[model samples]
Target: MIPWIELDSAAIPGETGTLRLKRRGDEFSIMLGANELMNSRLSGSEEALAELSCAKLAGRKAPVVLIGGLGMGFTLRAALAVLPGDARVVVAELVPAVVKWARGEMAAVFKGSLDDPRVEIHTGDVASLIEKSKSAFDAILLDVDNGPDGLTRASNDRLYDAGGLGRSGRALRLGGVLAVWSSGPDPRFTARMEKAGFATEVRTVRANAKRRGAKHVIWLGVGHR
Candidate 1:
């Protein structure tokens, strides 16, 4: 049996808790208290987050995409796989350490996706970027907090609120997509997406690629400008 090894820990910005990085053999996990925020082995849902959202931007030439959270680059790698070479992906990661871990200890997991010419790393709040933009993105994929119920930081709740969703709508180009990944479903979040003038679809995906694990939720919304 392999034992879990703690690789590193960093405090959550503007929050009291810390995020712990651990590894057991080839598997890695980012933990916030007792909850696992992300795991290297279970990347299906995260990959689906990008696949489903990028599919919405299929014919759009040179699309600009915004990805919130840099968990393990699963979504980023997935998006890069589907998007054309001219497309741009801007990833906003709230915690700087997460980014460090990505480029450092977790580089193998990321597979150099961060170095892709089409990818940009924003070491700040995703909300700030969305709030200040107007139709600047073709797609916005959020894997921020655990499904809207947010287990890491209290500020993450704002990203799922009505006002936040409104900003996201305005940040995206007409007919652009906004995809959110969650550990579970949130009915209110779905309702809010609709109220924000988006035609929403809810999807249940497996946590791992084998399609045999805990069911996770992904909400895809196409904004109507």
Candidate 2:
């Protein structure tokens, strides 16, 4: 078995912990402290995030989507696959190094999703975008941190709170959807979405496409029409 090799490291802004990129042959992993945030080999839930969200906006013309976190670009790629050619995807990644890693070492993993004409990369907080934009996006896919609990950065907690959910709802068009990816389940988060006027549904998906890995959760919150 090939040992994991640390390719590079980057500090998480506003947090003491660092994100380390490691590779074991063709497989890649991104770790924050002791927690493995994402892996190239396990992207089923990430892809599902985009697929499920886009499903809600299927008939919308040139839908605008906001993706919170680039990760390995699984969500972005999946979104581009299902969305129409004119649909726009805005990806907000807080960590600049993560974006660099995606374009550099993890380029192959991303498979040129960054170069897509319809995709835009924002190296800033997704919350800011949500707060500023009113009824702008047709779908918002959030894969930031571990879940609503915030494992990478404490500030990410606001994105899952009631206020944040309100901002997200306001930022979305009528009948828009907010899809969130989590390492595990959080009933409280679902309730918070409901309180913010979103019809929510939680789905459990396999980490791997083969359906052999641990189950991850995705919450689909549909905005009021």
Candidate 3:
């Protein structure tokens, strides 16, 4: 096996562990110490996430979107491609270092998402952004800390809990969408979204456009229309 080369490390705001970006040959991984948070190529959930959230309103007025997590900026880049010119993309990344890494070492992968006119990168908990806003966003995509189950930071649990989910529901306008990318299915989570009064749907997408395997799930909670 080849050794993983250390690419960079960033300290997460209000969190103990630092976000580390590493690479081994062509394979890349983002980690918080021993735990691997996300793999570059294999994580197609983000693409699906951006797609699901942006759907149904592609040509509408300036759509305001909040994306939690800045991993590789794949989701952000994808969203930019699909959204209209007037759309606004606000990315809330808990770790400032992760933002720096994305701007530096992973610059090419992110391609201009950081400097894009429609983008606003916030170095704080995404939950805070949801809590502070009131029916402000057209779509909200939660790709932070591995779904509802938080492994890297204990505080991340709040983002998937009852209060966190409720805040997300309230942050959206009527018919606004809330999309979450999980590694696998979680029945309890789907139930929670229903409890929050969202017309929910659980969708599975391929890891890559050409690959064949069990599809990756992306949960979408649509608010009242």
The lDDT per prediction is: 0.93, 0.91, 0.83
Q: Give one digit per residue, the lDDT tens place, for model 2 in 82-174.
A: 999999999999899999998899999988889999999999988888899999999999998888867888888889998889999999999
lDDT of 3: 0.83
Error of 1 at 97 (Å): 1.0
Candidate 2 weakest lDDT stretch, 10 residues: 145-154
Which candidate ranks first by lDDT, i.e. highest?
1
TM-score of each: 0.98, 0.98, 0.92
Stretches of candidate 1 off by over 4 Å are none
Q: Once model 2 is optimally superposed onto the true structure by TM-score, how far is the C-alpha of residue 15 displaced, in angstroms?
A: 1.5
Could you report the Cα RMSD, in angstroms, for every candidate shown?
Answer: 0.8, 0.9, 1.8
Error of 1 at 28 (Å): 0.6
Flag clash pairs in model 2. none
| Model 2 regions lying over 4 Å from their true place | none
Those runs of model 3 whose alpha carbons end farther than 4 Å from true positions after fitting are 212-214
TM-score for predicted model 3 compared with the true structure: 0.92
Output the worst ten-in-a-row residue range by lDDT, candidate 1. Answer: 148-157
If ranked by lDDT, best first, what sequence of candidates would result?
1, 2, 3
